[model samples]
Target chain A: MKKVRTKQVIPLFMAGFAVVFGWVGVFKLGFWNPDQGPAPGFFPSIMAVVMFLTSILAFIQSFKEDGTVKYEKQELLVIASGAGIILSTFIIGLVGSCFLYIILWLKVFEKASWKDTLIILAVVAFIVIGVFGLWLGIQFPLGLMEYIL
Target chain B: MQNLQLLLHGFQTALTFQNVGAALIGAVLGLIVGAMPGIGSLAGVALLLPLTYKFNPTTAIIMLGALYYSNMYGGSFSAILLNIPGDSPAIMTALDGYPMASKKKRPGQALLTADLSSFIGGSIGICILTFTGPALANLGLKFGPSEMTALLLIAMTSISWLVGENPTKGVVITMFGIILASIGMDTLSGVPRYDFGNMYLLGGIPFTPYIIGAVGFSQVIKLIMERDQGKGGAATDMKLTIRGSMITKHDFRRLLPPALRSGFLGTFIGVLPGAGATTGSFMGYAVQKKMKSEEELGTGAIEGIASCEAANNAAAAGAFAPLLALGIPGSGTGAVLLGGLMMWGLNPGPLLFTNEPDFTWGLIASLFLSNILTLAIAVCVIPFLLKILSVPVKYMIPCITVVCVVGSYSSSYSMYGVLIMFLSGIAGYLLDKNDYPTAPMLLSFVLAPLLESNMRKAFIISGGSLDIFFTRPITCVLMVVFFGVVATPVVKSMMKNKTAGKASK
Candidate 1:
């Protein structure tokens, strides 16, 4: 059996999506309308066919390459932190979640001293809250805190 | 004369107190970001894009435009001082700049050469854009749906050049971008597309946050993964004062010729679809290699530094023409600016020249202002910019991440934008690791909607017949060229095989 490397997975995933697009485009969405114009799915159908063919070509070409991608521990930790911040935003709001995420990453991963970490934290908070919120007037996600208040 | 009057009017608009302040802030921020080793202009613009949301359309664009133009000047600072290039366009600058600095012991002069040539080249590019912009827009006004579709097709094919080593991979990424863009509601019919039953999907992915996440947040991930990669080179102990940076008359004469030549060449290249400043610099350097130089090319030569540095700055200026005239972004940074135009409630096609002359002319005028401001500021702040290089990557990663989060959230005032940002950041990182270029994806995302709209319009005009693409004279020529571009590599490979078979026999 032939083995696909991690690099090949990107194309395969694209191919998988292409199949779904093509399927839905033809049966559910419709490709051509009675107005002799394109329906909602017309463009998607064209893209689906092209993407499917190109992804297969990419898959075939990936066999010429060597080595699977190795994910480092640091990358995973960073991604986890990103996910944590994102999930926490639903509860604590953007400003709060970012405050927690940044503080933890600096203290734990970077091993920064409290002095430096706090300074960085203070600057970051001022920029996010003072500059972005107060200065620009962008309304951020209130999360569960809005209801609680 | 007509363009000149319009340009003077534009300068009047750009010289306003608020606009001038915006331009100044953009210039300083641009230099800071451009001097930083890993962050390119794409990310820099994306990070700061949120700041301009509150400003008026003209003011906002002038800020972004100045930021984008000054970025080219900033890229050369690190390239000359250290061996590392701040951006891809500066890669050629580093070839001669580093040796000129360290080996020739003229670190100050090397930077000054880059600044001077950048100034000259950028002036030429801005001049060309001022005249060409309205003419191009006038020409574009003649393009019907069929002609527009063909022109966009040619533009779309340019993505193949950015695909890196794998053409197939480029196609995959381009298609993926189109698919992503198609996820929102269908504009014509008001029907939802590829939304997966999510409410946010109906609104589509936010462009600014997507850009910030893909370009900025992904860099943060890379910094974390390779903690030791951001090390600064030995840059201390050099007399970096403006007086110490002056070049001799003979050296200036040598630099002037190459800078002038590359200025014209780079501007034309920048106007081409997807070529941008990186290719402009490379081609400029390549041409200079055949010409006579005062010193051997690439080993501390003034000509070598001038050629690429000038070309890149010119190309950055030239990219605005297509963006303003055709509503087509000539580079990734231009795509971000195009997205900004959409967000600002302005249409950016052929009508832009007639409809919004102040906005168009003001942006063009600001480039000239930025060219001067950047040169003076770049020369004065070399000592300050060098300090930014020493700030540890660990510190940079967190600050940049917070900015990315906040910027994403601000784009649409929701968590949905942030979620898309994180997801695309992962996708961007993966693409970067595997040698798949992210630029083509972003460009495709911006172009797909326009292309789809035009093509559908052409079909509507043609009554569902395919001849609409081939029947019109201008469309015929563009389509023919598009086919030729697509077929050349395939034909060349076939010829190579035939020759190989004959040789084996």
Candidate 2:
């Protein structure tokens, strides 16, 4: 498989953004309203058009430069860790998810000693649950805990 | 006399035990946070803002303001000791400061110079704020919608041009921010524009979560990616001895002039919307370097550290001038503070003085104490802070990520906010990687609503005519400045090309 060029990514992203913003501006929010001084969609629709034009210019400019993505194992692991943390938040709630993430990230990704992992887990849990949860009285989704309690 | 009386009154409010305690805590935490990599004062302030929700406006502002200024002080510590600038503003400090610490073996002198310069610059900046803030606020009161729109336009353009090498990317990112800001119901009309189908869209995307994700979480990801790299070895064998003999009388005399000059220059730059501490510090360093022979600079010259440190601290204070007076944030951190002020149910601008004198004055007064406290705490805690730097990158990454997740969740008490934060983090990372300046986007996001609302107001008043922006004297001047800011670089590039053509011929 051919790797995507880094220089091309931005122009592509910009083009995609323009399409979405333009579609939303015209279809979802009407282009204009005569009764109102300026319609709700006026600014957004203008922005969409500007973005579309600028992105074309950027695309043309990008063709002159050549730079490709260099995928590395460490970078892939970091990306996976970010995704894992986000997915875990919905599954176990913030406090619980943080605990799971810290353990997995330390033991699996970083390959730290189990003792170090456990110490980190304990300290993180204490702060999240004790300081934020109990003291601040901030609420969070208790995915598994909700069913158990 | 009037200013003095107001300042004394401000001190009275700030001197309360609770306020004093909050200031101290804020200073210490700000120092620690600023000393850490991947989280500067802007992220530090944004992450901690939710915790200030319960406090009164005065106490909250005092704490945040103290945190904001002391963060500047803390940034220099890591810059000097480890050549790793904890924040952009401290980058200049690292150039000369690291050399002083490592090669000259005068780390203590370098730290002391930075601390003293910061304190002196900050104190002068506060004095400037006290006298100028109200007068500027009075002037701001005269500005109507037209003037406001023009001013905001100038600010957006200037920031976009000045911040990064790629002006086109900056402008595009800024437009994106404005588009994001226009997501909720239109302020003038009751009609919802970009809700798509969700009920949550009506209330608009919350600022806190987006900021936390963009500034805080994105940094966490970057740090995690680089976790395997060894920490800079500069701080290992550092020994600090704080004595008068460290910086001789001759050194002090030589440093004082540059420090004083840079302090004023930084303060002036800070008052301008979109110009920040980083710009001020760089400009100060450039001017100081230009004055001396090339050999004197980048060689641990005391003047180099003094000028940069003074300017950056003064710029932090100068940033408050526009914020307090015109409700326009002068820097990215100022933008965050503006959001916090709005959250606290206080409208910034001229009316804030009349509406919440105690809050305004208390914040100003706290600045004085925060700087002094920062100096004392930084000097005493040098050993402890150095220890913090030794903590492995892997440990810091996970801890910060958890904090970001929890902080985002706590802000709105909604899963949606967390999702937005995570997505914003990804967006921020991509944007940063692509060299699209995030500060312009953040600034535009903060200012978009104001600009749109005022533009609409001007149109309504002028019966849908665009002439209002050009008719009013102040508005006309602002519009001209806006055009000047946008055109200057284009003209300069054209001239450069022409010069090269001539030389080739």
Candidate 3:
């Protein structure tokens, strides 16, 4: 119950932060010139205002709310790990990143055997290479492999 | 007689070797994609759309149309066997389907029932499209920006029921989507808004990448997180045995009423913007629940499958209604279809009916053939497809992941698209974690630009008076209907509560 309240309230606070940043991005930064009828920052400025008002309403509502749900740490681990994997993929490229994420998550995090992880990794990598790269002619970023090859 | 001539011409168009080959390929691929969890018909069609850039407009549309209808049938396979609905519309089916699978009383009976109902509903829907699409297109010719704006408003309001416990949150999300939609350069003024000096922002976010990120990548993350919880899919052990006689006499008798009812329901709902298969299937399921005598429902009833299957296929056909008449999509899949239509250099509206009668009628006729073909293919292959269930999830997830990535990259040959894919994926994950429905958010984003542009254009044209929205008779009538539709659920809930109070008294 307490967790749900916190979850609801935090987004509103974050949205408030969004408003401040968005406002600064537009008005404080001097991005809009006097001659500009509707500057590139104009719409975002409006959005920031709306976000700020909505966030305030959200904050008010959070206090009035009753607790109905619980948040779990496992869920957060999933979210963070998934995000981490995706970011790492961008840096190391598809194959290497996917391999690292799969091997570590399965073997270490999931407590699966090394042999099982290796088999899973090999199958995924080969098929992805075969279907996406070869058959479909899609250009997946090779990452560091690009320089090596 | 005129109908006969049109039908003949449609047959001529649909029966060509190229069309047949395209239909066959489309049905096979669509089935495979639809059987995978969370990869809806929309994604499947969108993934295949670029290939059509090389084909003739009619040929390309026919292929996509086939894929669309095939997904309707194929989606049911996963829903019944796995209790994991492959598409949003199949959710209702999973309720009864999972129980039926647990009982193992009938291996393929439920699936066959669903497929047959889809066939029946799809045929009816296609017939409606053939006869009514042209007429509606003719009517749309008279509409201007004001009327279009009113129509879109009606559509958006219908989503009020979908807003969950917090209508405000839904509205906020929707407003956010609309605002995001307005980020790109404006068509009328040639002025950019929120592009942030990036040239990529000029074209606005491409529909395909946003969709894949918001839907596809989000789903993958969700599955991985819930992997051990078996939130992935129900593990059904029984193999489906496909046979013509699997649909018993009782099944046929039980099926027709709900199939026809849901078919009409789906077609009508499909005509409305934002009211696609998800809404249509729910409505059909709700109607079936009401009609059932409490003894027949939630216990592997064939009628349950019939109603949902009927509505889903009908909705698939129904979504084409507004697209053919107004060039506006009623759902996410419809948006992709609209893109395909535009790619063909074919603008759908009243002008289309007169200028390209053959194209319109032929497309309608091809839909009819596609449904029949899907039924034939699914029935013959159901047993084999069900065998795929025995394959370990460990192997399947990676393959599906590859498909998802490929689908995203194939949308455009740009690395930036992949970047957008990951960003949207992250956003989707956050939204999912926060207990927000991604569909409404995605929907609002898609409809935002249309709503804003139309409202702006109408205001400019009307010299800033809101009267333009009311001046048009069709628009006024539509607005009333929209409010009524949005209010019905709330009203029904209130009425139920009142009845309970009276009973207590």
Query: Where does model 2 exceed 4 Å of error?
Result: A26-35, A134-137, B1-122, B132-134, B162-168, B220-225, B232-367, B378-383, B431-439
Q: Provide the TM-score for each candidate, comma-separated.
A: 0.71, 0.72, 0.71
Go through the candidates in order and give the C-alpha RMSD of each one to the true structure.
7.6, 6.9, 6.6
lDDT of 1 by residue, A1-149 (tens): 23336688888888999999988887788999867689879998889999999998888888888776676778767778889988988899888888888789889988889997998898788878886676556667777999998
Which scores higher on DockQ, 1 or 3? 1
* lDDT tens readout by residue for model 3, B248-344: 7776898889899999887776676555676677667667865853236557777788888899899889778778777878777778988988888
Best by TM-score: 2
Question: lDDT per prediction?
Answer: 0.80, 0.75, 0.67
Task: Judging by lDDT against the true structure, name the best candidate.
Answer: 1
Reference-based lDDT, residue B429, model 1: 87
Candidate 2 on B1-505: residue-level lDDT in tens? Answer: 7877878999999999999999999999888766654357887788778999999988998999999999999888867865545566776787688788656756777788888888878887888888888664345356678887886676455554334566567667777777888887888777886787788888788776676667667766666665665342334355433442157887788778888889888887667555578767766776685476323766888888988899999989988877987788866788889999999888898787767878888899999999999989977775554453455777767876776677667766787777777788878776776666665666567667867788778887887788998889989998998788678769999999999999999
- On residues A63-104, what C-alpha lDDT tens digit does candidate 3 reach at each position? 666654454665455456545655665678765666676776
Candidate 1 scores an fnat of 0.78
Model 3 ranges off by over 4 Å: A1-5, A14-55, A64-77, A88-92, A111-127, A147-149, B5-22, B32-65, B68-118, B187-190, B196-226, B229-233, B237-365, B379-435, B485-505
Better of 2 and 3 by TM-score: 2
Q: Which lDDT value does model 3 have at B238?
A: 48
Between 1 and 2, whose lDDT is larger?
Answer: 1
After superposing all C-alphas onto the true structure, candidate 1 shows an RMSD in angstroms of 7.6
Q: Report backbone clashes per prediction.
A: 0, 0, 0
